[model samples]
Target: MSATRRQMLARTGAAGAGIAFTGAISELFAGTAAAHGRAGYGPLVPDPKGLLDLPKGFRYQVLSREGENLRSGEGKVPSNHDGMAAFGGKRGGVHLVRNHENRVTAKIGVPTVKGLTYDPAAKGGCTALALDRRNNVIGERVAIAGTAVNCAGGPTPWNTWLTCEETEDKAGTNGYTKDHGFIFEVDPVDPHRTGAEPLTAMGRFQHEAVAVDPRRGVVYETEDAFQKPFGLFYRFLPKKPQGGRGSLRAGGRLQAMRVPGIPDLSSIQEIGASFDGVEWVDVPDPLAVRTPIRHQDFGPKGVTHAQKLEGCYWGGSSVYFVSSFARKAEGSAGDHYGQIWRYDPSRRRLTLVIVFGPSTDIQLPGESPDNICLAPAGGLMVCEDGGGVQHVYGVTRRGDVYAMARNRQNIGTPDNPEWGEFAGAAFSPDHDTMYVNCYAPGTTFAVTGPWHR
Candidate 1:
């Protein structure tokens, strides 16, 4: 049996996943207005190390960094750290499974362990980190190796990590010996349990992140294709639902979402707007051997498409997903900095819960909201991936957005300081710590402070 939906969300600190906490989309904008004042910890204080800035009384420690030697001595830490998940370990410790969104050209890649390597020629995979109660790194090693573009993924109901490949690159195209673009299950506590095999039945495409429905044992997926064609929202029904580790490998049926008259989600701008009688359409070819899943035919009614569909998570009995941003110049139906949508399985309905901006103001609180997780304190913690200063923002249940942390790391010269987008923001089961990733000059951080409860 699987964990109940509330138990899963509670474990993940996703109880606040419903963006419209007050039950009104209008409250989101009102909260935005209230954001002018402070909603979270007062303001961020600069870090002397120039790595990360947090509010007073809060501190961050670098748990892992690119090119650093791994504790296992298998190899150095890989580059392009992306999505991650935290699980409770023995004696008040925490275990994290992190993804490396590397390609063939990366200088340091996940080492090819004998049984863990999926394709020696490929340079993307996942790594596991073991930390004690004090947030000290106790053990670290490659969880899965030899994949490609391992991007954002989700945690399972039975204590496992699902790592996704964000590329459609084929075996021979870029020195990859095996076909890329599939989800792989990684056990945080035991590396050997991974088996390093892709779940091919979930469909082939540029997958971003996933959210598992513990109640129904369903997996909701998001695609992050850059341009014109965009991407589709997907759900996979496993043959053996919630059978614990490695059960997804058994097989599954893949399907895309359809919203009746709405061909593109970007076209819907009104807040709180929703569509009923939402349906799922079967993909003619889940493998995408002949045509990509989104490009495949779904008849005249067509299927719903969204630009830059990224972060996904399950909470409040609904599947919450994000559209990082869309631009009209790039062939989208409309333009917006960010959007958060919720699909309620019980109601068979989809609603637009949060809308960021159509404005170009870099200082806006909601600019290009990427990886998101509901905070244990009853709000959403959003990672800003837009231009200008990079920040980890906090959005309250009432919709107020505030800066919680800032990337002060300057990887470049004073004339041009480079800051990477934050990804994989998740909280511990005890709600005492939060873990996130810095995409460039890859670094993993464990943040601790006085959080609202």
Candidate 2:
């Protein structure tokens, strides 16, 4: 009768649900990499040495760093950097919206402007940085006040940042408001405004990143819960068309995905293989109504639990999503370490675009891909979440991959570099400038590339 019980019955048959106490296991355990077929692709480019390295003529410079003294007298830099977006710029100058993924850190001192402390541990959140024509930090301000674990988020068409909290526990461990997981709208210019509120209409979940569909007022969200079944990939369609401009408080429709014709669990295992093919069924009304088939249903058969779905963007006619981990099987030619999938609205299908890392035989050795962005030169730029060598990777539309820049800090060893993981890749309106964030050290970099065809 309940959602969980219905799902269990659907997977193991009505009769199997009663066998739980009879020592009969209805679930099948398969190796993580055994599902999904290989997608075709070759290596793109070798890793880079400098903080950022692009094709000839392209160069990058640090716009802001954690612990750096800001013009506002805020001593030291911010940590746990993530999602970023550039707005209101012409040629070289612009305003940047960035997220600080720190939940609680005694070293940073609760980030408050002047004499205000929203919480004893309000350090983890989002910030607004003003940049000059040359991509230099002129000023920085805390955009969305009193939020935690502000991770990867997308830019709205109306010029605002949708900062998402990566945790679900609102009543966080220390009895602090627990504002770790939820979506918040931040205005870069007036970040410190007292009326800013969290949008509970987005539904409370372990939100990782979000992408807004400007045309439809639809918000596509990704979750990062691994242990509790597969995380759900959701879409929030505001009740009133074009209603989510400066506020996400208006309730909306939330929907998940189903595999459609795949009646048996075994068929679900075959869906992740080849990228060129495969279809996804959209489960309408995931938040409002209960459905027997959910995204987590596919996890037992090696599916990356839809919760691992991270970054997303509206590219071409479809929306593309990135999976941080989807390793290949023991003897498969194509590796599944990670993959880029596209959801075609017109065709109502999902397709694999690029496969990264050794599993796909595409990445060098240890390249775990994360937040991605569309390049001005017609390609996708992916941030590496791996070791000391974490760098930004460029994958052309033609499937050719290359390393765009390095994270500047080595995360693999004990030294544990200060710079965090490179993430939230976004280009200026003109595509001439690229802005990236380091997740660990919580720093932001602005780079100018030589535009060459």
Candidate 3:
């Protein structure tokens, strides 16, 4: 690594949740772009292959492509790859549970395997890819099947993947035989442990992602609704908190977060602004049999709502989540390009860590940050889901931003040239490789480099 990157890493490791850390992040969002250096590897060197562009010393390998026959011979690889999680496997290898965000009408859906199908008519779910220590794909198969619009989910402390359905399509609607929108657990190591069963107790309505608090076994979830009244941040209090696999299936209480005076998260503009005494309001109906969770009445002080709530993960003692963006034109109460909020369970506080752009510049580091994961080298890797060019960004602990990779392939016509969004964004168990997926023409990539220790 360069001296600049080394210093940045050292500083990131030493920084804590204090004034210094807050101020650095504030400057980043306040348009003081001059304060940041190329804290990561360096500027992205264009890919000669015209696919993914990465830094000079970095390289990426394509592991799977949509429409291709699976090695397992079950069917073709599914399309619209989304959320994912990586776990340690046998002999220092890695296992990745990946989501296929296919709607009921998609041409190539996750293959239905015996015992894995939740709804034979539904066309979305997850698949597992086992890679050797050197990152070579050894096995791939359908992990969970027959779910709808499986978007993004978090991993459990006990070594399982929670695949979420990001839809509200009910039974008999659009050919769905059962209610969609619920979280399902998948065992990447043991296929027998992954039964395609939905955790119904966890309120459903377009779930985008989830974060599990290891200490309390609470699952924090985000909703990505496009209509007015948007989506709410939720937490599922499981009856068998911390019980190994199938615990969530036992059912739980679902509740949404409410900040005293703030009705919408997008209204908050100040970075490091903390809200204390945040409360949770129970969802009267987790199943959304009639009204969606966010649309349901939460008594006097209504449940707090935010637009484009996506990407959530637990780190340290806090659970961090993202609001992709908001606009008054889009029925949002307030406007901003993106916001990353951290909530401390012990203190019951929610603080705004970073906010970026209401600008037209797609080059802004915080433009539509989605599917975020804390980098092992002391930072956060954010997948950009905004307009123009899409990039995977690295935000240092001190809030410096750098582009880690760029999507250069044009999946659309030459006149349109559409670059699909990047999703998943997980690191291998060994931290030597980063794995992420391209949502269009569906593709999975394993990236390796001279990472900073």
TM-score for each model: 0.92, 0.74, 0.92
Of candidates 2 and 1, the better by lDDT: 1
Candidate 3 Cα misplacement greater than 4 A, ranges:
1-37, 363-365
Clash counts per candidate, in order, are 0, 22, 0
lDDT of 3 by residue, 1-453 (tens): 321222111112323333434453432233222223447776789888888999898899999989988878999999999999999998999999999999977879999999899999988999899999988999899998999999899999999999999999999999989989988999997766768878889877899999999989999999999998999999989999966888888888999999999998888866667999999999998899999888898998998899999999887678888999889898887777788888998999998877755434554344788898867666678898988788888876565567789998898888878889999999987778999999986999999997653
Error of 1 at 434 (Å): 0.9
**Is 2 or 3 the stronger prediction by TM-score?**
3
> Which 10 residues in a row give candidate 1 its minimum summed lDDT?
1-10
Which 10-residue window of candidate 2 scores lowest in summed lDDT? 25-34
lDDT of 1: 0.83
Candidate 1 RMSD to the real structure: 6.9
